[model samples]
Target chain A: MQQEQSIAFKTGMLSICLFILLGLLYLPPESVAQQESSVPPGTAIPDSIQLKPPIHIEVKDTPDDAGGSVTIRWEEQPVLENAVIQKYRILRASVENSVPGEFIFVGEATNRATVFSDGSTDDDSTYVYKVEAVYELKVDDTTVVTTTVQSSVSDEVSSSAQWFNFQRINVFVGVVLLSFFILYYIYQAQSGKKLFIRKIAGLEAVDEAVGRATEMGKKIFYIPGTQDMDNVQTIAGVTILGRVAEIAAQYDTWLEVPVSRSLVLVTAKEIVKEAYSKVGRPDAFREDQVHYLTDDQFGYAAGIDGMVVRERPATIFYMGAFYAESLILAETGNSIGAIQISGTAMPSQLPFFVAACDYTLIGEELFAASAYLSREPKLLGSLKGQDVGKALILISLLVGTILETFHIWQFSSLFKVIGE
Target chain B: MRREIPLLITAITGIVFVLQYFIPHAPFNKMNTWFSDWFSIVGAFAIWLGALNLLKISFQKIMDKKSDWFFALVIIISFFVITIIGFAEGQGFREPGTTFSWLYDYVYSPLSATMFAILAFFVASASYRAFRARNFEATLLLLSAFFVMLGRVPVGDIITGFLPQQYQLSQVASWIMTFPQTAGQRAIMIGIALGLVSTSLRIILGIERSHLGGGD
Candidate 1:
């Protein structure tokens, strides 16, 4: 009897021990140490328990921008004991497409982020948003609990296109100020005022460059660049071309302009014809003088190269928007002992032109060349006005630097243009 | 009337463009698109004019037996062959595996690449002249170019391995690029921007009319 009783107790104890082991293996982890395994700080636990949602959900249209965006802001709930806030999940629904109270997941942000810019909104549709807060609770020494709570849905809000982007007020003011200066100077010029312009070496060399070609009795090659007529650089180039054409016509020198774009060819021919007429040599301007080449970039370069080699012009003028071909053209001109004058706004190609050409007009100097060559009072006044605008910009830069360094003010922020 | 009409149009168009920059409203928002569409239409017609001009010039050269008339003949033949192929292949001419695509890939692309490849030789020859160190400015340019070139290569690290990390030649090259080079580029950019603004203003106000074949 004693042996049978002992065996019964042993079996019962073994069954109970096996049951406890299975329970431990299958149940959700309760030990805080085990649950905290390798979880770095600030990572949200997906399992949520009940908590107070963020309060005062606010929705507003994004200001000073094109439509199609709404901004969401919320105030966090008052802190409670044992509830550590995690991240907030944002839910949004289009009023046009969904049943009431049903929403699709839009985005999420950390608890610290109070504002969210929702950019995927349609300009015409109204939207409602919900802000849900997630939190963690340590109920006991061995257990960590997660909870989530949602706030009331925001009222329907829609984004509308703004008529004026006020954020760019600073840029508008700058442009207006420049216009005022230019107009005032132009009026001064129209009334009888002598405007002094600092002499530009490139413009000074022009008359000499043309004179050399005339003396040598060689054809003058004028390449108005590879760009079409629409580029501002090309316009500057062709304007300078007018002055060059007049000089060429006066000298009775042969001038050739092999253009890459058809429109540029037409424009150049018109300018040359008018220039010739102005010089009392209308018969001298041939339609074929300004001709078209292939529109391909490198092909245009190759054609110019071939012409330069064959014709061996004494002077070559490269003015406009040139790319890699700038070096090719300049180097070819260099090899033939031709005087090369190049002007372009392209910063990358400026180095090449400076390296290879006899005279180079850098950046703003290209624009100034027209006025410098023509010596028109109105144009000269405009150049002088540009100097004034540049002066103002210099003042702003100095002021901004000093103010920022001293931490007295953020003067640079005034120049920040926010909207396009 | 001829000059006045064009100038008026230019002024109106310029004003509308400035308005569009400040306002995103209906007609202003679509003005640029409408104008660009018109330009493309004109450009398409101009392409034919260009082709005809090329043909006329080439034929004239071939008939007159100008120097290198054979090249003109080749240009004419190649132009027609490619035009015929492009038309015959229809809309799918640009698709892969088509004869037109094959021609573009094998002939046109290689020719373009060859032309671009010639630029490297030109750059080398030009750099030889520019980096001559003839004066103070040239010597500065030469030094900067040498350091920039050295730092871009693996050998730069090996050469400066004994120096402190910040004092390495590669780091020096990076500092030059990040500071002095960028400053110069930005200065030029600012000048260009001011010039562009000033020039555009002149054009809009009709103070600059040389582009329209009128004297200032």
Candidate 2:
């Protein structure tokens, strides 16, 4: 059975129509005559033929790319007097044996967008694209009118890899400049030049913390973070672990490292074993010392929390990337009254480490820890080189901000690396 | 020979990758993909090293009756249970209705979420300790924390609704975050980037060997 339209809704709609007609009566005689000839409500008023179909469709291979992309552009057609354009849908198909039915929806754009990029196309394969304008002319809340007009299909174009990404020239220059400075400094250091590095409180306390743990006869917990070996922070953490393992070996303090990633486990195990061997205490290094926890973040945190509670390590070192679990691990170590030293380049997690740990290595300090502990001249040279690089960046940022504020220049783009 | 082999591999691959960033042509692009593929292959196999080690320790603890032997037993049991079901069920184990996925959803997921939830209490406790005013910097931190905390909740609007827009606590909090906090974060990020560059160069040149567990 068909549902009947409500009498109240019909009456309300009629009253609205009567109100509009009454308003039209106050208009000038010429405008009133025009209004009388208007189409009835909820009727399809065909748009004028003057609204041109989209034309001048063009497709070009995306520049500065290793193939597999095409950028499409076309002239967007104007809308009729009352017709609204919702969007432009892009369609693509193989140039050979291509039919209108074979075209696939490659992407969509806003009504105002004049271009679309399709990156899914294969290299060396010719393809064609068509742009369709989708517009909606709604007569009322209960009725909507939609229409589509397709542009002519674009000519077949093929994508090929470029030899060099010219857009990334800025990145190339920056890398070369930094490498020059580092290499020059390294050469200088090889000639017996001493490099000065500022003291880091966290690094300086390594010896004291290890001694305390040794004297207390309790183990030290070394968490190289919950991240895999691919992270640069984990690499930094593992290097520091090398230094710490040596200290623990020399002091004869038992060390335990719980890891989440299997690769980190293998890497950390090898580093600790080598550190123990270097200190002539290879017998003291146990294979079980560097244990593997589940790769699940919270599961790893739970394992550490339970171990920290039960065994109650004398000292804990969190020296890598951490996320939401940073505070949980730190606070638990705090509750056990263990001296905690934490370090991470994660700006968000730095505050939690600073709040809960006895000493915190913020940002670059974690990367500098191994060099600081080792005190090798060549390594110290790189620190000096890094300082110089930082000085240059600081100058750039200061000048860029002031110039941008006063509109004296748009200088920041000099440091921007496109296609990076 | 052992150290030299690793160092040689590191240097050759690192330089190639640095070049790959600027060169989009063949060979370099192909090498980058090849390198990443090799990394994935090695990573897949590296899991066995960790799993075997984990089992060795767990078994040792249980057989020798060391401390926390029950936990070791639990780890062993859970590991085999998951591994066997995963191997047996293959792709079907990932189905929502299957036993493996059901165990993951019911047992593992809830336990993980609970552990994450515990972080909320830990954060409160940490903030409490951090807020104690012992010095000038500490006092400043405490004051900032007070405004930031108050501005985050509905009561802040109720308390400061009478004030002008600029002087309101919420405005102050937003200003602090947009300017000072953002500035500090950026500075750290810049420093980290420079440090990473320096470290990467050191590694590629074999000047930093502590990662090999020794200071050259």
Measured against the true structure, the TM-scores of the candidates, in listed sequence, are: 0.86, 0.83
For model 1, the superposed segments whose C-alpha errors exceed 4 Å read A1-54, A75-90, A93-98, A104-114, A118-126, A132-149
Report the C-alpha lDDT of model 2 over A243-362, residue by residue, as the tens digit.
999999999999999999998988898899999999999999998899898788988899999999999999999999999999989999999999999999999999999999999999
Clashing pairs in 1: A48-A146, A48-A147, A49-A146, A49-A147
Model 1: per-residue Cα lDDT over A342-398, one tens digit each: 999999999999999999999999998888898888888888888899999889888
Model 2: CA > 4 A from native:
A1-49, A52-59, A74-109, A118-158, A418-420, B26-37, B85-91
Q: Cα deviation in Å at residue A85, candidate 2?
A: 5.6
Q: What's the true lDDT of residue A13 in model 1?
A: 100
The model with the greatest DockQ is: 2
Model 2 chain B: weakest 10-residue lDDT segment is: B207-216
